[model samples]
Target: MGGKSRALPPTRGTLIERLRDPATAPAAYEALVAAYWKPVYAQLRRRLGLGNEDAKDLTQAFFTHVVERGSLARYDRERARFRTWLSRLLESFAANEHARSQAQKRGGGTAHVSIDPESADHRLGASAPVAADEVVESFEREWRRALFEDALEAFRARCVELGKPQRFDLLLRADVTEVPPDGSRPSYRTLATEFGLELTQVTNELHAARRELRACVLDALRARCVDEDDFAHERRALEGSDREIER
Candidate 1:
């Protein structure tokens, strides 16, 4: 509880039915949008480097387009993260930077909510500090990092089931207090103290936890592609936590 839990709490039936039946399920659409909107917008602003106005518009239009355009089906969780594939789509959108405006003009074509383009632009452009490119980069390149996080979540849930969720909590909250000049990773000592464990025990648990998480992430990414080679690259890309594809 030190910081906000960022992972989505598991919701079994409602979200699945909604994702599966977006056409008729009003509740589903809202649920999907609620879960994804921030991440989508976060990708736009933090990785793609869009201005606040453009990012906001992009976020709205992205979800609208996904629902209407029958693109969500393309998101196979097995092969890629919802985030990585999303990053690619976002890149395509960003490459055609002017398209969001035009897409907004066209609207959802189904009496979808009529969002004001100018208002979105104003909101997106509200913050000038973060560049579009930075956000975009974060989206694509975070495959490994995101996967690690997902793995961590999976591990946490697994531990919770085993009645020891707090045991590995510290790894979930790993943070850099001081940057090593050479960019070396922090030692297990810091993590041990934070989680209240002996150094040796902490090291072993960290290894098990990270390994499990890595495996979980790779498993998720593996299900996304038709080609094994592409999947391998995606897994490898996560190693350096760098962008796998150039936009």
Candidate 2:
């Protein structure tokens, strides 16, 4: 470690319980919506053939319904992953065209978090409408991307706090940044020259940075899970790698 050590970010060990607890449910719902809203919006657009405004309104309304109805409190982690359960709920919500219309007319209330369409819409871009099954397939990919993005942001902020932002820059260039067309990364010697460090120092810094990033990613990933088993399963599926999600 080349800088002051910091504790890992918060993890929600009792996510299920917190969602069920009235006192904690608001905050829990906020975190849940923030994590899943993009995928929900995307699925609504693709699976239901809704335009951006309709999808955005429906997304906001769906989460509002969930929060008002205590829908997440009914989630049984043993039955399905949180995302799968939420997807089912979204499908039900989207199926009710009358309800969707009403929600849109009323201008869907804020659902414990702001539903920003601009960023999600930009990323979704203009693609031919995908099938319902394809929407489901893409949902998992979107969720995985969100996980790593949250992790990377947390890691970057932590590096700043530790006065080792260069460590993150080094890691980003060496690993996170796009590689050459031939799939080659900058050599360690090259990185050393760029960062003004010895090769040994570069190696040590990268190792430590990677370890910290893994911790940050784990924190983000685990916070969305209901229990230890769920976290373990997800960690295994991620395969202990830091590869960027292919859009």
On TM-score, the candidate that comes out on top is: 2
Write the residue-wise lDDT of candidate 2 on 32-84 in tens digits: 66666666776766665555666677778888998788786677777987777
Pairs with steric clashes in candidate 2: none
In order of appearance, the predictions have TM-scores of 0.51, 0.74
The deviation in Å at residue 242 for candidate 2 is: 17
At residue 112, candidate 2 shows an lDDT of: 39
Going through the candidates in order, what is the number of backbone clashes in each? 22, 0
Candidate 1 overall lDDT versus native: 0.57
Worst window of 10 by summed lDDT in candidate 2: 1-10
- Cα deviation of 218 in candidate 2 (Å)? 0.8
Model 1: what TM-score? 0.51
Identify the runs in model 1 with alpha carbons over 4 angstroms from their true place: 1-39, 46-60, 63-89, 92-138, 142-145, 173-196, 223-227, 240-247
